[model samples]
Target: MSKYLPLSERLARETGDQWRPTLAEIEAVLGFPLPKAAQQAAWWGGASDKPHHRAWLDHGWRARDLDRAAGTVTFHRDPTAGQPPPPAEAPPVIEAHRGVGGMALIGAGVAVIAGVGLLAARLMKGRKA
Candidate 1:
């Protein structure tokens, strides 16, 4: 089954294309990652039969409602009353630093300790001699 339904018969009449956005497109527009379960629900049809298609439609409605509430973009729904509020904006992205600063500090500390130990050993040997 297709991940998205064809534009509603009414909408198709108004809009030129039967174009419907996929689950991935919706997530992209929202600029966030959805939970695995929600993603599954949204694309369930991408792998299976008619029920998955139906599930995608049902969950897609909820997701679209959330996107609208977050003010990411405007969307219209048929009959309109069942719409939910927009979802919250996506959280900021995290970046990991790959610099060796931490490792370098540890290496410097180890070297200092080793030098102190060697100096102490040499002084003790000199005293014994």
Candidate 2:
């Protein structure tokens, strides 16, 4: 059996999906396209046995460790540096309609109050004249 048999079988059985690459199958599933150097590092045994990928293991290079695992290869960062942090999440967007509706309601209220006050003032002034 190929070294990737277990990973291929697991991916097929769990996700009902098949990926043909002999190496880096897990990375493909995770949507992280590994660089050529990373792939080679993983192929040479620098990652973990798990399906997940990490840039380091035991605070050291794990490229060689990953090479020994069956199924798909994993990539690891060199011992000198840790993996970069995950990308920042975008803030949720607020729709404009709600804000516009609030502003419209306030404007309408002010207009009605001003109209009523003007009518009351005119009536009082006409009575006095």
Candidate 3:
């Protein structure tokens, strides 16, 4: 087995879409310190032939971001790599007549009806007088 197999297993166990592993964290996972060449960004790049690259790629992860200064690499899960696509966001439910607005509309309708009824009552009273 490849020496990087431990790293692959660790990444495979992660359920998040992205992982930011520091160089030290990666070293711990691999059970050894990274080589001097690992300081370079190209060393963390995607090269299917590279054992280290294959360690993550084979598990549906890709090195998308690297921070050489911070000594960190960010791996993103490959959606098309036999992994289920993220659930699509459901459309928002819009109720034109709901909540306080609906209540206000009903209250206004009642007020208008009551006002008309009072006006009719006054007219009838005047006729009776």
What are the lDDT figures for the candidates, one per model? Answer: 0.44, 0.49, 0.86
On lDDT, the leading prediction is 3
For residues 30-71, could you state the per-residue lDDT of candidate 1 as single tens digits? 455534554433432233234423433343321233232233
In Å, residue 35's CA in model 3 sits off its true spot by 1.2
lDDT of 2 by residue, 1-129 (tens): 334344334443433222233455555544555446544544444335433332223233333333424545433434442345468998776876548878999999999999999999999999999
Q: Score every model by TM-score.
A: 0.26, 0.27, 0.59
- The 10 consecutive residues of candidate 1 with the worst lDDT sum are 60-69
TM-score of 3: 0.59
Candidate 1 residue 37 Cα shift, in angstroms, is 45
Instruction: List the candidate 3 regions with Cα displacement exceeding 4 Å.
Output: 80-129
Minimal lDDT window, size 10, model 3: 77-86
lDDT of 1 at 36: 56
Tell me the lDDT of model 2 at 45: 46
Better of 2 and 3 by lDDT: 3
